[model samples]
Target: MEQMQIDPENLISIDFENGPYSKTIRTFRPDVYTEDGTYYALLGPDKATGILGSGAGPDEALLDWDKQLAVFISQKHSPDDPVAEFVFDTLGTSKKDVG
Candidate 1:
């Protein structure tokens, strides 16, 4: 298994054609790996509140991660929450340390 430690700030949005319409998906930088043939996409850090997704393949696991993260985003919370801050401000494409 291989793992990559990313800055998360470099996350990019992908444009894909869905049938007749074009869609833009802000891709999460999922750490993809395989274990015993099952694939997994681990998002964020490895802690009690970390996000992890598992599936038969890498793409499936990434999809699962996106879905779970979407739900988490839809929930209400305070701006001071670390996880939420990281996900929406740090990990997201928003430029934080700008001039």
Candidate 2:
């Protein structure tokens, strides 16, 4: 598995993995929102290239969501490099709370 971190100031760090060599790509801008003093991370893969937002503080829920996404992609698409597009369409369109 590969890993990557995106440091975009206010946004939470996005750690992602594609395979053994492909690191999680970071976006320049992240979409962020606060709810009940908790921040949530949102990634608009279609609109933005990388992270859309990060939940406030340490968001286990969001992290889990991301992990699930990675797992799903790995299991469903395996060695595909462009799995992000499929993930974005499948998960992003559903607008389901990953966390």
In terms of lDDT, the best-performing candidate is: 1
Clashing pairs in 1: none
Over 1-99, each residue of candidate 1 has an lDDT whose tens digit, in order, gives 123454454332223233221121234465666666776666655523555667786667667766777676776645555556666664453423211
lDDT of 2 by residue, 1-99 (tens): 121242355444434433222223232112344455666555444313333334345444355435544654444332333435445454453323221
Off by over 4 Å in 1: 1-26, 77-80, 90-99
lDDT of 2: 0.40
Reference-based lDDT, residue 78, model 1: 57
